[model samples]
Target chain A: MAPPHDEVADSRDRAWGLRVGTEADGTEARQPVMADVARLAGVSHQTVSRVLNGAPHVRPGTRARVLAAIRELDYRPNSAARALVTRRSQTLGVVSFDSTLYGPASTLDGIERAARTAGYFVSVAGLRSLDSRSVQEAVDRLRDQGVEGVAVIAPQISAVGALAKLSSAVPVVAVGAGSRSRLPMVSFDNRAGAEVATRHLLDLGHRTVHHLAGPVGWTEGRDRQDGWRQALEAGGARVSRIGGGDWSARSGYEAGRRIAHDPEVTAVFCANDHMALGLLRALREAGRAVPGEISVVGFDDIPEAAYFTPPLTTVRQDFGELGRRALELLLEEIEGVDRPRHPVRISPETVLRRSTGPARRT
Target chain B: MAPPHDEVADSRDRAWGLRVGTEADGTEARQPVMADVARLAGVSHQTVSRVLNGAPHVRPGTRARVLAAIRELDYRPNSAARALVTRRSQTLGVVSFDSTLYGPASTLDGIERAARTAGYFVSVAGLRSLDSRSVQEAVDRLRDQGVEGVAVIAPQISAVGALAKLSSAVPVVAVGAGSRSRLPMVSFDNRAGAEVATRHLLDLGHRTVHHLAGPVGWTEGRDRQDGWRQALEAGGARVSRIGGGDWSARSGYEAGRRIAHDPEVTAVFCANDHMALGLLRALREAGRAVPGEISVVGFDDIPEAAYFTPPLTTVRQDFGELGRRALELLLEEIEGVDRPRHPVRISPETVLRRSTGPARRT
Candidate 1:
């Protein structure tokens, strides 16, 4: 339930009137209306309206002039009046879980940026848990607010399942929920990224690579682990699955401790860069030189990855691109476009640095 | 200008009716209204109204029963209707710059959590630049959408200055802009945190400490540096001001490269843990062991800090608590509470880890 907004009604109402007029004395100067823009642009009011609505009939030169005048006057069409005419809020709701994590956080940032560019406001609801009830409640709350569409950053399996079970009146898109989802989804090539990282170590002459996975329930983690296992088996190399970490450096360090002590361990592939930092530290402390005694690779070439002791070789996920694409897809659905439902997979690229090298002669 | 709300007027109207009834086929079902809640609690409609309005006349047991009925029915009062009566939006706008960094990201997550708990929706607008034009435009956009109040997470000097010059109609709170601003503000004690981190090394018997600061314009960076300088001056120790980093591991590595060659440098305090991670790596590459030869401490005890090679002894700022406090203060002001105009400062604490140790015998 949204809190009442009337607490500051008096002050807010006064400010609303002042917003249109620029006079310091609170004179009624009024913001530039559509007619003012049309007059300044030397175009018909209908043409200016056409430009604003992105209609195809307006000439390019006239559109340019109208846009220039709008920018010059800092014209913002009154959203309330527009909402009344169109009966659309032009706002999108986003449901995100574990929003502090790099991937989710980056995705959320991307969504906000893209939404703004598309002339839409973003309302975000961060979930503390992945329970089905919580997901339903969040959607219901957003629905009550009358958003045009929704984007759920559902990385966890449970979250995706809950989303699939729920029905929304507006268009909905899920980010990072894998390709098998029933709803429109956008995801990075998590499986292929892990496969490339694993294969990089294999090509470096490491017989097999040890895996340090992210926490269970995350689709990305599971997909990456599957890819690693697939690559190892395809190469006929022995596969060693280490206990998974909770996508934290501490968990990576703890996992690295056990791997460092094993003489047979020659190479490792962590799910993310933070864990790779821990792995590097563990190997260094154990007196095992990186690349000389062991090779390491990580996923998600986070900003700090390049500065890791020996620099890190990892896969990069373009979260911003994902967000942009997701918004575009959601908008298409909201605008009543008859596009087919299919998952949009953004490709991931491997970033080679000093972290991975040819296995030394035993 | 808020968008029109007439597009789904028919469906929404029907939903409003169903909210009070429990008919099958899901079409007849509606959110429980106050009347329904009253009936379920075996109380008069006026009594339910009194409970909802917090009139203070209801007995404790009756209040509990009303609340329980409300909860069981998942009743949410129609915010739009309420807004019509009270002229409130029931939404809070957040203006944040650099929404991807850990501190800012964590703070955003905290704001969302706190807003949800307070039964308010959070609308976020991310600024691409700290220029006053951009800041003003973002605020105008949110304002056009009718947000009740705003929380501006302005970390840079330009951003703080921009926020200070702007006149907002809604209650506004700036976070992390230092304590000198005229607007209500909430901030973590960056200076004290840095001072404690620097003094920890000084107390460990280090002759002097090198400082790796964040990029220029950020108040956190400047405040932390000031604290480090103050601590060194108080200890009568030489302060080596190495060129600052942009709060990134790459910049930290570059700064560390210069510091590692100087044999006189015995301790270093990084403005952030990310920079500290890079510093540790640079020292390791330069063959100068941490603590064994030189000690290092960092601010912002990030989750990965403890997982650094020897773990990091750093200062921790409660970003979530800061967000919560900022929202609380903004709400008070919005509710017309006559609170004093001053910044609310949250203290920082040092987490003892293995990053710092006694100075090595020269």
Candidate 2:
């Protein structure tokens, strides 16, 4: 349906417009079509279209004239008309769950910046749950809104299954989903990051690094655990799972209280920074000096991580880069590029800080 | 324009439908209109409308028949049709800046939850800058996308001015903008929160509290500073201005390094918890014992605050409540409720933790 007349008036008032050579009565009027720009520039409609579309083979003088006409007419391309013609909305949808979390939130911020830079509007569908039904509904809603492509920040196992089952024609990119999925995905190298963190502790002369894992069902947590186990086995150190956290400080504190009681636990690796903060508190209360008696490390160098007591030695994920690469992959699919389907894995860098030190002499 | 045929087919495959009454040829067909349900139910169209709208006065038996017919026909109320008839898109647009920050991010999460609970979809236009042009463009973009109302999370001073001058017909509620503007707003009591944090430090027997202010131009920062000054003046204590932070840990650390040199500084209040974390780090590195040589406090008891070194004593702003209230006010304006123009202020409470204690006996 055509937009209401008032909406048109609102757009006219806000849009940039110029009073160029105008009507037969010598009065300036609104220019609503490409023909008006072509007429004012004394150029053919095909020339104007070529200029607008950046088509090759246009003369410099003709291109300059078309540009001048566009500016003079204050002619902004109508997205609705363009969508109708090309069957594209030039809009990307982001389906994010629990965006308040640092990982998801940072990823989303990156996606928005990248999408906007590529001249696309981002419509976010925030889901309250990671259930398959909720994921499917959110995708359907975005599709109904005419988004040409979608980026799903699906961090959970169930969400990956839902993405595989989705039948929408719109191209989809799943952020943070493991590389096992059939859909295009961009993710931080969780297992590799964890391996580096674990190796850092082993290099410090610690016998083994006790793991405080994130909750089950999260691909990140599972991958991190796998990396930690692999590092321990390769180092010929005993692998012991102290406990896990729900990626919350309270849960970390609860798990830390148990780990603090074990005299053999000299080094600990937390899945994320928030849990590391809680572990620090529990260790301090238990009279264990950070890096003096026990070395600690965490993942996701969030903004506050550097300010943690003694500063956290953690792995930093370049969420912005991850988000940008995700958009690039999604756009390639949207633009119908027949590229090979390979997941993009962004490497994480380990940041050395006061939180990790050489293990105490036996 | 009508939605393409494939979209309809996709919806048909997923939508709930069951064959019941048959046509003259004894075959069930697609039902796309309310009249089809009414015909199958042997009821008037008005009765079906009343049942769908949950309007009172429909007989129980008639309502049941209409509901059954609706189920059998898979009569999903079309949002486009409803929007055309009622001029309501059932969507709320949120204009947010720096959504990666804890306060703005939390507020946005809250608003999304509240909007979803109200059966509305949230379309977020995340601003890259708080400039008037950017603010106006975001609002215009959302309006063009057909949001029924808007919640502008305009914490910056210039954004409030932009919101005041907005000419769009859609109703707007400015969240976190100071109450000085003509538009309705919902905000955490920044002044009260700062006042309480300052008073807590002063009441701890400190001669005066040094302030780590947030950057200028943010109404939240300005109000927090005002509250801190008011508390100091009310207590008849000397006020000293330490350096300010840009609500970032790096800035806070830079400011903290400067504050650590002053021998007279016994207590300090940071604008937010992230900055407080930096302050703690600086103090520890300077060998100043927390709550022994100096006491510290902060505003915005973010989730990680309780796990900070020694746990931070801070003011808690209910960002979720603020967002929920902002949606309520915007919805009221959208529904044309005759209400006063006063802004809504959500109170903040001081959370006492290990970060603050009695000042040292100098």
Best by DockQ: 1
Instruction: Report the lDDT tens digits of candidate 2 across residue range B1-362.
Output: 12323334332232211112235663444435788888999998889989989999999999999999988865755454555456456777898898888887788888988887887878778897879889998887877666778899879999988987663345788999975777788898899888988988887889999999988888988899999999999999998889789888888788878878788988999988888888888888888888788788988899999988889899998988988999999777666565567889999999999988898785
**DockQ per candidate:** 0.30, 0.21
Local distance difference test, per candidate?
0.82, 0.81
Predicted complex 2: DockQ: 0.21
lDDT value, residue B360 of candidate 2: 77
Name the lDDT of candidate 2.
0.81
Per-residue lDDT for B308 in model 1? 75
lDDT of 2 at B55: 99
Show where candidate 1 strays beyond 4 Å: A1-85, B1-82
> Measured with DockQ on alpha carbons, how good is candidate 1?
0.30
